[model samples]
Target chain A: EAAVTQSPRNKVAVTGGKVTLSCNQTNNHNNMYWYRQDTGHGLRLIHYSYGAGSTEKGDIPDGYKASRPSQENFSLILELATPSQTSVYFCASGVRGPDTQYFGPGTRLLVL
Target chain B: GDKVKQSPSALSLQEGTNSALRCNFSIAATTVQWFLQNPRGSLINLFYLVPGTKENGRLKSAFDSKESYSTLHIRDAQLEDSGTYFCAAERNNNNAPRFGAGTKLSVKP
Candidate 1:
């Protein structure tokens, strides 16, 4: 069974619009991460949350923001969408340290 | 040199054959995790290694922190094993992992 679920399996937004991708996990995991997968590039971490109320910057977090208001939910927000940010986004949840991560079904986004 | 490099960006195998994928880490990785992203786009965890080897069904994995590398072996491959495989490793520094580009495997039955 998948421990994590992501919403808006597919989305399209105009440039400069606000876009948010939501994720929910039933695994009671202490860590959640958002990554973007683009062609020829490995999944780059956009942002991550240590737990409810704790959000941290990841490898590629300049144009993205993450929010974790509750233990079960994590949201990745792109305040001003751009074509460069268009990619497949994935959310993952896992235990505390050095634990295996479980990813949710990806969300494909297009910005024009 | 790349931080993490996986050999053979893609692979094709017969349904009942065997194959091995590899990951070489430039940084001092403390832990490694292997994942299989199915066609439907769900990344399933295959193995998590602190250093050593583990096996599940037809899949086997090995991690050597000293050598900074990991290997995943598939035995008696099946059509259902087709997908992209990824290796993510946590460096010894701040625990951030550098992921390999991935190896896309297509198993024909």
Candidate 2:
């Protein structure tokens, strides 16, 4: 079965601190995505990568950056963590087959 | 306008009853996928539709491209089925997918 795993299941960051959330997938999928889920919003895309060395900003890309170093690894970075950026982050991987996407357990982050 | 809208933001039902959740799209979509987020916060893929209906176990889903809407029907609702459900649609013009806000369902004994 295809699996997508995330590191630091739970994180707490101080204001202005830098935070990195890591994701690794064993599915060999070409597309990977980062999303944040809040209380009101369902899930908003922050960044997406089509392949290694490529990244595209999603609707809510502000305050966040993404990196795809290889087919199996994708990372989301928060340059300066803020209280507003505190939310659960999810990582997903999919192929262009227009098929279903596999999502990770999600990393819960709290910025103080 | 919101790209994707889900109806019945929250629903309450009794065990063994049935209910339906819906998603309406404003951005021309080519593919649709439904998911169930368990209490533990894991989103589980339920169905992937291409303008047609698909059924699995006690769940069924249909995506209508022309009407820009999708429906998920849960039959014989059980306590274990209570969770938040989401539908995401991928536009034909791009790889970007817009997701509905999600419907929270609660099943009572």
True contacts kept of each: 0.68, 0.74
Candidate 2: lDDT of A78? 97
Tens digits of per-residue lDDT for model 2, A6-75: 9989999999999999999998899999999997689999999888999999889999999999999999
Candidate 2 similarity to native, TM-score: 0.98
> Could you give the CAPRI-style class of model 1?
medium
Write down the lDDT of every candidate, Cα atoms only.
0.90, 0.93
Q: Which portions of model 2 show Cα errors greater than 4 Å?
A: none
Residue-wise lDDT of candidate 2 within B23-104, one digit each (tens)?
9999888999999999989999999999999999999999999999999999999999999999999987567677888999
lDDT for each residue of candidate 1 in A1-112, tens digit (9 for 90 to 100): 5478999999999999999999999978988899999987878888888899999888889989889999999999999999999999999887878678888889999999
The regions of model 1 sitting more than 4 angstroms off are B92-96
Count of residue pairs whose backbone atoms collide, per candidate = 0, 0
